[model samples]
Target: MFYKYKCGNEIIRVFVWNDDFHNEVSVEDTKTQKSYDRTIREDENGKFFTWNRNTIYLNDWIKISMKELKEKIENGERITSDDLCQAIMTDGVENVRFIAPLNIRCGFGFFLNGNEFKDTLCKVEERWNREIKQNYKIVLIPVESDDSVANSADYYTEDFVSLIKCGNIKIAETQKLIHQEQSNEDYFEGVNDYFDGTMGV
Candidate 1:
């Protein structure tokens, strides 16, 4: 089963059912053309959208595709390419996770929303009420010069601070999460490694 959407001129197809486990395609707003903004526009047309492959309607105008892939992106899953446009648009830089450059040659950056990302402690909705509250984001570098995603990094090894460590307060990777419930301390422990930590400063 697929969840389809029509946003402005874009056509989004989501591989929903994991029964056959085809592709979760967790990324959103995928257009035939790569050029897309997360904000849904209501005034455009010329695209087609189908839901469950059962229902589809048409608006009018130009039916054009935006992306033609000549090659597949390596490790793009870590970049969260699906969420990049929206995250950048909303100033929610803290919501992105960095793994690598789109290409060492291409300055293009994408966001990877891994299966492990959403349920991670950093993005958890329960934070605002916690004592050491913070928004966590993952960076691949050694340290964040400041709090901005572009300059931030939280590199770590399993149960060890390999290089850079930044969070609400300082937390070591040695702490293990034993509590079935995620307490305040357990929250930080969840991000113990760079996989890792989301309890950002």
Candidate 2:
């Protein structure tokens, strides 16, 4: 399975598990197409070790069953997109937390970090509510299957626009559409449309 994340200007695409012989985790920068590989390590004692303490903890969090994850979410713990991505890799999509549209098929994808994306969605929803004063449903579409690590911005924007269009999320008034070029400093704001919304599942 694979997951995508937008961290600053870098689009991080993580291949959790693949048919590759090494069974290593492959992380790729969508923009540069540069990649790195990390694998679970074992110490001399025959005990498995994660890349580091943080990753070991992350792996533990990933091991939490979906039921537990939901409970944690209900208990007010924020699940980072990184956590979700790792969980999806470890547990598979069907077993991961969050809701997906019934129409979403096997290959459909979601943002890597659920909490961060949700916060962004909330911002868009608030903007719409303030401007339009009408409730609107936001739907997230999977990144196009053919989206490449190189030129991730294209597919990411396409998916974002598709979500808006698919849900009929329109601006209440014609305002200057600010287009900010992606940069290492603040890519999230650059992609902000001020008209996005969140999906129920």
Candidate 3:
């Protein structure tokens, strides 16, 4: 199942349900008015995934679509590691098991102008912990870079040790950092300590 969103000045679309499926569409430019396409696909074990043909601009205001917003909720097109894993397995040819690593990248920055990249790993991890068996070691791969989404020249970097790998260390650290960064004060002492507790880092 997939959803289409055309909110505000941006015409965003999401084709989710099965890992080999994803497409994010937006206008090329506010001035020129061209059409651009951004698509991302991957597998269950996190071995094989790719994002192809997407455009990005340095401008400020991100155009969003109201139609797209309504559709995402209606279709349940949120990105998750399980979604990636299912995509890999569902799309695999024959019995050819994809024996590669997993890359869990949260594209938090705006690939489209108005779209904010929200992280969904915390929820996905909880589900995976309960549902996924112990025979398989699911490596968490995070695409860490400015252009990890539509800007990478290659298939994008997939690191095995992410916040998931280190338990919730990164999460706690991120929370403290966010508070400090936003408030402009070192109010939280032992922030790193809290993160360390999660992973013994």
Which has the greatest TM-score? Answer: 2
lDDT of 3: 0.31
Q: Order of candidates by lDDT, top first?
A: 2, 3, 1
lDDT of model 1 at position 60: 26
The number of residue pairs in model 2 that clash at the backbone is: 5
Supply the global lDDT for candidate 2.
0.34
Model 2: ten consecutive residues of lowest lDDT: 117-126
TM-score for model 3? 0.19
Please provide, for model 1 over 51-99, each residue's C-alpha lDDT reduced to its tens digit, 9 standing for 90 to 100: 3332233322112111111011222323222232222223233332322
Backbone clash numbers for all candidates listed: 17, 5, 17
Stretches of model 3 off by over 4 angstroms after superposition: 1-9, 21-125, 129-183, 187-201
RMSDs, each prediction?
18.9, 20.7, 20.1
Each model's lDDT comes to: 0.28, 0.34, 0.31
lDDT per residue (tens digit) for residues 29-78 in model 2: 45567777766555544422233222331132224333444455456676
* Displacement of the residue 10 alpha carbon in candidate 1, Å: 15
Which ranges of candidate 2 are over 4 A from the true structure?
A: 1-62, 94-98, 101-201
Q: Return whichever of 2 and 3 wins on lDDT.
A: 2
